[model samples]
Target chain A: MKQRLSTLMAAAVMTAAFAVQAQQPMKKAPPPAKAAAPAKAKDGITAEFEKFREVLEEDNPAELFEAKGEDIWKHKKGPDGASMAQCDLGLGAGVVKGAYVQMPRYFADVGQVMDAERRIVHCMVKYLGYKEEDIRKQPFSNDSKTPDHVSVITYVAAQSRNMKIAVPQKHPKEIETFRIGREIFDYRAGPYDFSCATCHGSDGMRIRTQDLPNLRKPAEAIRAYQGWPGYRMTGGFMLTQQWRMNDCFRQQRFPEPAYLSDSITALLTYMTATANGQVYKGPGIKR
Target chain B: MTAMKTTILCAATLACGAALAEEVRDYRAEAIAMMKRDFKTRGIATADRVHEDGLQAICNRTSDHPPKAIAERLERDQMESIKYPPDGKLMGDWKAGEKLAQSGRGMTWSDKAGVPGGGNCYNCHQIGPQETSFGTIGPSLYQFGKLRGNTPDVQKYAYGKIYNAKAFNLCSAMPRFGHAGALTESQIKDLVALLLDPQSPVNSK
Candidate 1:
């Protein structure tokens, strides 16, 4: 009886082994070569992105901000009662057309390089004689309406809408700003210890259903950088470029960035320079 | 003899397991204390933000996998904190919602008290088209209405998720916009319209 029991146990063990072998076949053939090389090949996630892009080709509501911004640009404002027509954006004075596309450039007068947003703030304060605190205090929108800052940025950016990003890098200060911005980009800290590169440096990375553009790549950088001062669907408010940078600092667990601060301008200069050839598409609509 | 050996082995194993569990508990406590000591409260960022609530404590202790019974109970508790709009309307103006999502202002140490805060949604999700400077922390919300349809159930889900993301997923990184008072009911409603309104750009082709 003992021998019979032992034989039965051996048979059971053999059956279990066979079941395991059947369940997990050894060395399954690789997927087709053509299938592997598809544009959405990171993990079959890109297939859905094609549909998203198709939807994005339609009209964006951020066009409204751009239109309003244009109006603000020509309208006389401030205690000086002057328009921003004479303000220089590194492309000569009062040249609205395509000026924004070449910003965050070296400015000899300011003795430093500045981004589009910082330059606008400078013009608003210095040339326009508008109080800096008043502009800063202005709500993103006036009770759900688009704000003046966003309108101005959109209008200015729209002037360079189809132009190539041409941020100047001739000055030594410009170079220094780029280097500092690069360091900040790679620096890691906070509860998650995440760096900007964690999401943006790698190609084909994503979070949930959104595709992360690799900021290191020129095309991606331009595609990513050109759209700012966008209208957001989730909050029902328009945002300025300064607000965008401030939020980025918040997510990084760093101290909140001062609006239109030098550090933020330097970072913007670096990013804009990196995207030197991409078409500008401002005051974008976003979900 | 065999019975006696088995009993001895069982006792030894139980003693070792108990010792290991106690060590782990002590280590966790030390880590929490260290974090509290190092964290500095500034402006809106208070020391209490670092302290875990009961639900968070459970998630931390179990590494996001509390016992099934405990998870269910915690979810129920969290649901109770959600406050619905008094007017019973789940959606408001999409145009207003667009502005709120775009603005990323207020609620920092530097910000003055009584100043309104921004939703900062573009930092994570793609809610609409035309936004060139959006981050990809959350999913693309473009065509949300067209894809999900503007049903009452869908509206409720969107509102609830925005209100307290943790209520749906215990460890969700999405901020509790409504529950935390980061957004008002009217703001949430506008956001809902931005996502679900057929005429909104989100639902447009």
Candidate 2:
């Protein structure tokens, strides 16, 4: 009890100190024209990042997807004349704005919980009159081809940008999904015996230089979760949460979870639920 | 300010909620149900792997921290699980070790079963000075032998540690390369030499 009390006090003090330190200005640097050694030149990368955000915010590359996504969203195609405008994303049909943040919600029509991509697949099949096989054939995008689904989801997700994350847990099934998701988050399997918890279950845990988020923490989980469906500069393409989970499973030495798999849905349910109060701040940029 | 207030209010309500009480009581059973419903077997990776082993279950429950007595006991069990080479030799060619260390492949759904896998050491440790791109998850092995000379005991220690890291310390994030069969005994020996042999670049440079 005494040890626990001291630890609690220490944590409170540290939190206060961090809050104070965060408000202080980053160390001023000399002009980049005469920069020092690459390692020592930057005091805080925050200022450098600030510059990137200032310049890049004007013409976000995601705009390409958003533009293309909007086109794909309204266009009548997919073997029959139809548009995704009729598809309901848990906020009723044609309601794109703020819908993404409210998602992984129980859809009464489908009687299941779904993320943006799943809803998109449902819309493509139902309203757009495309087969699940044809739609799943190219859910992702590559340089050679921009899959209609990838851009469409990006546009839909962007509508909820800067909105509060409000994923519903009121439905009994939604609650059950959250419970199941937490389990999958902790489930350890694969050649390396890694669960998501192996890297993401703790604070200060990192793989290489990339700091893993402790998904159990709301603040960290929200910050991390909202930053996905990112524009991967390395791959030079947009990615959805499904792709992110798939790649992570690949890294875990686990089998591929088929596109829009239940495991991925459950994991997203757990993750986004942890992000309940964070402002949606993505289709983001990635290193 | 609104977000903070909302969070505090929710936390306060949840702190007194019966749901929170239920979660505390039934987290494990819920986890088992989740794995059964969601996980699927493919190739060498099976659904049963989602179910944690006894030691891993403890690690999961405690977030990789068990109480000292239980941890020590579990560590001993893990140590006992290690199967050293039949020849009792704990060193192999560091050249082969270096190649294995660099390649981060194998044991995934795509990897063929029984094929030798990479050590993937460089993914979490800096082994040789020549390799500039290396991970910082583990301590550097650059000059590992130069710092800690490779005696027979040291060689065996390296071999054993790589074989079953939890044997040395309970709840080590490092995988049990040999115990999990991700690497063979001979492969572990190669890795042992990669870290402990004088001629290895990890020591020479």
Candidate 3:
């Protein structure tokens, strides 16, 4: 299963948390029997992880990346001596406010539709004169390292906090992208024959103790929409929708999708559109 | 009715059928093309994994609920492909099965090619009394052997089910451990014991 590793890691983290707090025999330790626990303490374990998430949410490190992103956004340091401040994020030249919610839109200039991260990386290569290959080589933040553009996307997402999701479907290409995205969402392949829909298509389902949000339903879809470009507690760095999608494919045992590729944008468009009308709670923190 | 009136009625019915067929767009063809274009092979995760088999095509298109006739046909094909253990034994050590059930390892990009993968059963099913952290995606198997009586027929069914769950249920969420070459014949026999051995925690209180 895609979540099997995460399930084990979640159990270890919770165990360590309780171990530190109590400083004695583990209250939740297994009985004299040598068998491992599965569903007996499920509710208690979920609540513990939930409580830890709330505690970390209060002191999110995403703000640090956001502030760094703002500096890069305003400063001029490209081949043309240009700044991202002038890079239009679909609103006009340099309108960052509420732009994140309305993106993955038709950009007539590029002749393609792009999500928030894709558009930001495009500006980096186009306006800043950064090589496209160089950017894609190390797009995601790992360990203590956070890339400048990832921070930039985080900065843009923060600007649209509490804003409504409104990914556009006006252009024919935009509509077509959304349709392809919906198809990919349900497409099954690989050794396990799993799709994104396998875990997320149903309601009130879970793998181990982790709750799977039904991306097909808007009410549940918001859970998938919000809290992305998030600060990962385990990895301890910022990550965007592109990295998240890439990991989903990895877990599905499929070949790696190219960074900022059209397919990723289409999938993002589908997810963003399905989550339309739900409030984007800005950049989030995750376990 | 006159022959002319009957012909007109048949023509109208055919037109309606055509319209319905046209409305159901074959999005799979275009989507598969997109995947082939955008995805690149890396490590053990190859490009061929993106291509769908006949069974996956049906399950994906129908949302895992293909028509009974089609599902039954495909399931028969799957059943024929299962390679049972040569020794005629269908059960193994329950302790070994317990370890395999708890593990959810192998077959990802990071995994080595020749290494075996875990059954990952607890991730979907509630098995044994001690493991209260089991998933609810599949029905609970808390007392599988106690309920079923562990007959030879039941043991064969359990072994077959684990080897290739799709053969038993055409669109089952469980992986075909043997069919996919993820688990060895001995490993599957062990799993059968986990579900059907009377002395196993799954069967005993």
What's the alpha carbon RMSD for model 1?
24.3
Give Cα-based local distance difference scores for all models: 0.65, 0.73, 0.82
Q: Tell me each candidate's TM-score.
A: 0.50, 0.77, 0.88
Q: Give the candidate number with the greatest lDDT.
A: 3
Q: In model 2, how large is the Cα lDDT of residue B180?
A: 86
What is the lDDT, from 0 to 100, of the residue B188 in candidate 1? 91
Q: Model 1, range B97-194, lDDT digits (tens) per residue? A: 98888875655555555676777776667676655445556667878899999888999888888887768877554667786676788889999999
Instruction: For each candidate, report its DockQ versus the true two-chain complex.
Output: 0.03, 0.21, 0.49
Give the per-residue lDDT of model 2 (tens digit) for B1-205: 5445555566768554554444455645765664566556677766666666887778777767789999999999989889988888899999889888987887776777788889888677767765544555676677788888999889988998999998987777788898888898888888888888888877873
For model 1, what is the alpha-carbon lDDT of residue A105?
A: 79
lDDT, residue B203, model 2: 80
Which segments of model 3 are wrong by more than 4 Å? A1-28, A31-46, B1-25
Task: Please list the residue runs of candidate 1 whose C-alpha ends up more than 4 Å from where it truly belongs after superposition.
Answer: A1-59, A139-145, B1-205
The weakest ten consecutive residues by lDDT in model 3 chain A span: A23-32
lDDT of 1 at B103: 77
Which candidate number has the best TM-score?
Answer: 3
The per-prediction CA RMSD against the true structure, in angstroms, equals 24.3, 13.1, 6.9
**lDDT at residue B128 of model 3 (Cα atoms):** 74
